[model samples]
Every structure is written in C-alpha cells, then in structure tokens.
Target: MNEDPGRDVEQEEEELFEHYRFKVDPGQELVRIDKYLIDRLPNTSRNKIQSAARNGSVVVNGKSVKSNYKVKPKDEVAIVLPYPVREIELIPQNIPLDIIYEDDQLIVINKPADMVVHPGYGNYTGTLVNALVYHFDNLPERKSDYYGRPGLVHRLDKHTTGIMVVAKTEDALTNLAKQFYDRTTERRYHALVWGDVEEDMRIEGNLGRSFQNRKVMTVFPEGDHGKHAVTHVKVLKRFGLVTLVECKLETGRTHQIRTHLKWKGHPLFHDLEYGGDRIVRGTTHDKYKQFIHNCFELIPGQALHAKSLGFQHPKTHEWMQFDSELPQGFQELLNKWERYVTE
Candidate 1:
C-alpha cells in the first residue's frame, strides 16, 4: 500500500476505545441503553456505561445518546468506553526519574531502557508507574483508584528508551486521552534493522498477538483478524548488512513498529523475540560473525528508540514537541557499525 502518513482519525478513535456494536432484534422490547449494555457486556458496571454516555461515547442509530435513551426494536446501537482497569494495588517506589518538563497539568519524561511501563503478571514492582506514584502525588487515574496505572496516556516497550507524557489531573487525563484517541499525537522512533532498506515505505497490516506465542505480536496481512496498523519508514543510513531508519506511527498497535519492520524483512537488530537476535544478513565468515556477536552485546534488547513525541497541551491547547537522545549503548553500537563499514 502507498504510504499515507495521515490515518483516518475516526477509525483510530474507535480503535483506541473499547467499542461495542449491537443491533436490536425485531421483537426486542424497549430498554434503557445503560441497562441493555450491562446485560450484554460481561463484567461491566452501570456506572461505567453511564459515564460513557455522559462523555458522548454512547450512540443510537449513529447519534449520541444519554444513558436513559431507550433502545428500540431494529435500532443500531454503538458505544465506546475506556478499557477496564485491572484490580491491582499500586505501591509507590522511589525510583529516580529523568524529568524533561513538568507542569501542574502534566509531566514529560525521558524513560530509560529495561524499565517496564506498568506492573503485570511477571513484573509487580520497579515500574514506571511505581516511580510515578512515588514522585508525583495525586496523579489522575483514567478509570478508578483500583487501576494501578496513573497518568499513563501511552506506553513504550520494556526495552525501548524514549520520551513519554503523563497527565497530572483528571481534566488533563481526559483531554490528553481524547487527543490520543483522535490520533493527533506525533510519535517518531529510530530503529536499527537487519537489512538494507533502500527507500522510504509504508507498512500496512493487521497486528495481533500471535496464536502460537501469546507473548509476541504478529502481522496478519489478510485483514481477517487483528487491529489495523500503519508505520511510515524513512531510511537514515545504511551499513551494508544493517540500516538505521526513522519510523513514524500513523496507527499505534502493540509492537506496531517491530512487527511491521519484521514483516518487511528488516527486523530490528537484536530483537530476540522477533528473530533479530541472530544474523539475518551479511557474510557468515567467522570474523564477521564475531563482529556481529559483539555488536549484539552492546544493547540490552532491540536497537529501537522513541526519539520524538508531539501533542497539544491538554490545558493550554498549544502544540508541544519533545525529543530525546539515543542511549549510550545504542550510540556506541552505531559507532561500531560505522567503523566496521569504513574499514
């Protein structure tokens, strides 16, 4: 597909929210939308549905409706709600933060490598959320206090280093969440991949968790499954066996950049989960193999960095952009490649 950096904002908005659509049966009796939805959506509460209705996320026949709106027979009903929060207790930990900018409404930070964004099954502490809760008091949560994630508008991979924005107030959280759902935020990543990508290109496909491997993501080109994703790539430099490229995300899906680049035959270097750990290109000579092995040791994981981010300020409505430098290991890896190519 031809590269179109701009994506359909409405489609992306639907993707961002947990969207549900239902058609009333011809013999169905009239019922309140909130009550109707709660019956159909398992583990959902009336309060959550009512909140969605107040936010203009509930609709009947393509028109926004209130929670009390009656669902009539033969009517098409749709609603978009924020994802449900996992009930996990948050424990604050005093982790040093690399603060880029901070205001009453929000904070921008440069996240380092090897830090998980939030607590999960295998990871329960030493996360960005833990650090955030310890450093910033009263950060707004998107859903309920049960939600361990506070002020997290977006996230990066555990091994990915980059810039991220966190909201500080409820108003700021709502506004910034809407901005992300509308696909107005700008995100750029720098990646070193294992191939000679000659020109700029766009990768379009559906991305979902692999059926065989739940921990990893895979691309579904047939469009039969998964969420739509798009990544625009521009070649920055080539070192014969590998190349450095900048990736701009049009649609953010889990592992979008890594999966898309892998589908294009250029997986990020040292990406163990996606088949980039071993040599995918270049000579198999013992000397060259040794050089590649040493290069892999330079970075903790994949050679990818979220170098830039841009969005409108939630409170001021003014556009703001932030950029971050590559980590020392990533830079040193590049230097080694440069020297190897010149020799």
Candidate 2:
C-alpha cells in the first residue's frame, strides 16, 4: 500500500465505458429505451442494453431510467457502461515472462514493473497479453459479455509490479472473475510511503475519477460518486520520514491504495501520479536532499508491489496462494533506507 494511492476502481484497460449520447430526432416515434439504443448502437444486443438500464447505468437527461421507459421525441439519451470488446487482430510477440505457476486451468506470473497488462489505444505491442498470446495458443477466447481481451480477467497498473493470474480456459476465466467480483480473493501489497505511520488503519471511501483531472482518481466521502472501496493498512516499519506498510485490499478498485493513502496524507514514495515524487518530509538541507534524490533514482516509480495473491482453484476448488519476492529496485531501495536509518 503505497501511502498516496490514486485512480478509480474500474480503471482496467478492458473496463472502459462504451459511451453514447443521442438526441431523439424530432420526427422519431416513441420507442423503449432498450430498443432506442439497439437501433443506434451497432453490434449491441438487446439484453446488454436492458442490463445497463436495470443497473442504472443508462440515463435520460441525467436521471437513471428503466428499460421500459418510453423514449419521446427530442428526449436526450445517454448510455455509459462497459461494452463488449471489439475483436482486434492480436499480434503475438515472444517476450520473456516470469512464470511462477502453470497448469491446464491457469498460470500465475510475477509481473514486472512498467509493463502494461494488455494492449489499448496507444499501447498495441510489448505487453503481458502479447507475451501470453505467443506462449499459449489455447488461452480462453473472449465472449460477448466483455471486450476482446484474452485470458485476463483483471489488470494491474503499468508501473505496479506484482503477482497476477491468467486463465487458460473459459471455466477458469468465469470462476476467477466471480471470485474477484465477490471479493473472496485475497490480495496483499507492500508499499513504502512518506510519513511515519505508527499503527494500523482501515479506510472506507467511494472512489471515482477526479473532477479536476480525469487522468487520476479521487475518493468521494459522501458516497454519492464512484464505487465503494475499502483498504486495511498495517505499519511494518518506520524510518522517521517514511514508513513501510502492508496493505490488504477489501475491495479491488483502480488505484484504491494509492488514492486512499493520499487522502490520509501519506502518498507512496516516488509515486508520480499521487504527489509522492516530491520531498514531502525530512530536513531540507542539501545533503538530505541529495540522499532522497538518490533514493528516488533507485526506484523511479511508486514503491508498490503486489506481494501476494490467494484464490480458490476453478476446477479442483482447492484454495491456492502465491507470494513473490520484491523486485530488485524495491529491495535495494528498502536496504538503502534501512542503512540510512541506522547510520
């Protein structure tokens, strides 16, 4: 749990909204919301449209309306929901991977920092998904319920290094997704954050994209915006100006730990997105500044690592857990801090 966590819970590459807005033509006839959407949104199923309306993800004039609601002439309609992925030509690349566990149903990889999980608009190649494609031919194919992403049911940030699981079959994909959706899977992270966090803390907040900056996520205390998120933090070590802490995710939200810790005034060390890149503590002397700068160079991104993951097997129903060694940069950075504190 890097102290200053940022971003929303739904920032996955495949979890983006398929947004549509329309003004009913003046001569249009009255039609059901689902029908109206189906006529306009190509390749969308009636069931998909109805499900969106049922979940209040579809709205008319800023108010959530049901599927049965009849559309009138000149009525404004807006739809914002996760749309099925459009199939794209996926090119496989023979990139190396750190495989920790592999079987017929699933494969666990200790993903390195700075690797994008899947390809998107700007990122087309050199991703974990590409490597998986080259390495495994029988990886589960995408269904209509989701956008075209192979094998992966969840994602990690481009800079977040940690353990991740990929499904090899459709059964494994569905089961893994359900486990994550039900919050039954266990995820633990290690983060080095600014400030001396002397004790354990639990935080609950509604997380959504920032109003000021759409690129980042923010917590909504009123619970009116975004989705509910929870995180538990326990202090593992204290180094006066910084602290090493362990985080247990109660809810998997994009940048939940980073944003929550930022809300608590302790952003992760060198986290560029959450204001951790600056010196938030310690003496302002030149020598101290140099030391901090050197530390920053050791770990260029946020000091966050997904240390452990636990979940039940899809076929066998047996519980499985895996732990990963910290990346070289993170370990060396911690050692430097330890030596500095002692000296």
Candidate 3:
C-alpha cells in the first residue's frame, strides 16, 4: 500500500511513471535523492534518474525536490517512471551489422569493440540496440529503464570485443536469458595477454565488488555478496613477453574473464582498468587504440575478442555454434609481437 493522502490516483498514474511504490525506512537514513532513485529503480540510468528528480518527479513526504536533496530515515517518497509501452517506436538506420548466424528465433552478431550493446549514460545514439531497433520490425517490451537495451542476454566489456546474441522475439529472449541462468550457454574469448601463463593454468576465485571502487569488480575469498566464478585459460601461443590465450566462461560474472586473468598475473595488454598497461610494449605501440575488440572485427573497442559462441537452439533443441575470426587489428598486434619475439 502507498500514501494517497493528497493527490488524485488516476492523474498521478498518468503524470508519473514510478508505479513501483516504496516507503523509506528509518534505518536507511540521510542519503541523497538521486541515490535513492538508484536504489528504487535499478534499471534506470543515473542521468535519467537525476533528470527525473530535478524535474520534480520525485516527492519526499509529498513534496517535490531536487536530485541533491538529502533526506532522513522514515521519509515517504513517491517516484514515477516514464510510461512503458508494449512496443516502442525505434527508427532503424542502415548501420553496419556483422551477422555471424541468423535464424527465425535469434541472431548471433560479432559485436565490434567500440559499439555499445545498449544505450545508457554518455551513450545513447550509437549502440547495438539502436542498430537492432532499426534492424527489427518491433522490439519486445523492456523490463526496466535499461529498456533502451532490448533483447540483450549478455554483454561484452565496452572495451572487450566478442560474440553477442540478439533475440528476435519474446520467446527467444526468455529461452536465451534462461540458458545463461542455467549455465547452459557456451561462451569463449580470445585474449592476447601480456606475459606467459604458467602452463595451462586453471584459476578459480570468488568475485565481488572492489572495496576501493564501487564501480569495479574484484576477486575475494568467500564472503558476503560474492559469487562463485570459474574461468579456464588455455595457452594458444607464446610470444616471449606476451601470450595469446583462449578463455572459457563457466559463469558469466561482470568482467569475469578479464578480472580473473588479471588476478592470475597474466593481464591482457593495454588493459588500463585491471592491470593491462603493465605489459611492456615491445616496438609497435602506436598502432591501435585499445587492445580489446568484439568477436569479429566489425566493431571497435578493445583487444579482447569473442572468437566463438555455442548454444543449444532454444526452439529446435539442435546443437549450434558460431565462430568468428580475430579482427585484423588483433592479428596485426600478434604479428608485431611475434616479430618482436623473433628479432
């Protein structure tokens, strides 16, 4: 139940989008309004959240307020989110899409490195979802504000390039997302990391948020909020200082492969976030921007590539797979590394 102590119910529903009602507890005290919005709506972007609060969509104790407004415990707040339509009208443009495989139910796309899977803060216009919006005749209803991102079952690092699957229908979305939850979907990444891995090493660790930064994930011993993560590393080739390795994902945690590799002392080169920059650039340093890219070379971003994807077809129950070759950029770096090792 919620407080309808003051305003009209129908008008309120039409006026504000926060249909998910909430009451502030006395224990959860004195936090900023924008942050409260985040806690309330996990799917909405921070930028949209701030704007909604500023525009007076947020009411504390039945009073409109700004994003920076702070509140004490036991505050009563009402929030409204933008109306969610069953189907949103998204204009499709003729953007380049790397089609790995396609069927009636799903599409396997070799997402480029620089391309975003969905839209959010600092990224709105140019995203995989935006392209997909135009690619499909209709998109299914979004579950949350992250709705801007449609039919996306998994995500690659903004810098890490790899294979991604886009669902064409609601049924496909359900089947694919469930596959990930059940750990049935198979994903593999090719990382040209710096330094040699210690002979086909298997590094397994629990992952959770970093203590120093809330924005980054870190490896930790068994503890609160930590999820069990398993990654398999196989040495593909050794290049003196750098080694090209293939990573297999058992559990898809945020940045699981990258974070695990970094923890295992064989960080991918040019990885500024989790220890990739430490690798010594042998000779050719000025050739590429970042070292991660998507599965195929169709996009731009990082040196990590999604080389392959395997899954049981949701509808057909047939075993299917898609393989993407390393982008020329990644190959070029490997060549230079090989040359450096030779000379």
Give the poorly placed runs of model 2, Cα more than 4 Å off: 1-83, 138-149
Off by over 4 Å in 1: 1-16, 20-80, 138-149
Residue 218, candidate 1: how far off, in angstroms? 1.5
lDDT of candidates 1 onward, in order: 0.81, 0.80, 0.65
Candidate 1 structure, TM-score to reference: 0.80
Indicate the residue-level lDDT of 118 in model 3: 53
TM-score of 3: 0.66
Put down candidate 3 lDDT per residue, 266-333, tens digits, no spaces: 77776767767543434445433233222223224336888888887766878888888887777787
TM per candidate comes to 0.80, 0.75, 0.66
- lDDT for residue 1 in candidate 2, whole number 0-100: 14
> How does residue 269 of candidate 2 score in lDDT?
96
Higher-TM-score candidate of 2 and 3: 2
Model 3 segments beyond 4 Å from truth? 1-91, 138-149, 280-302
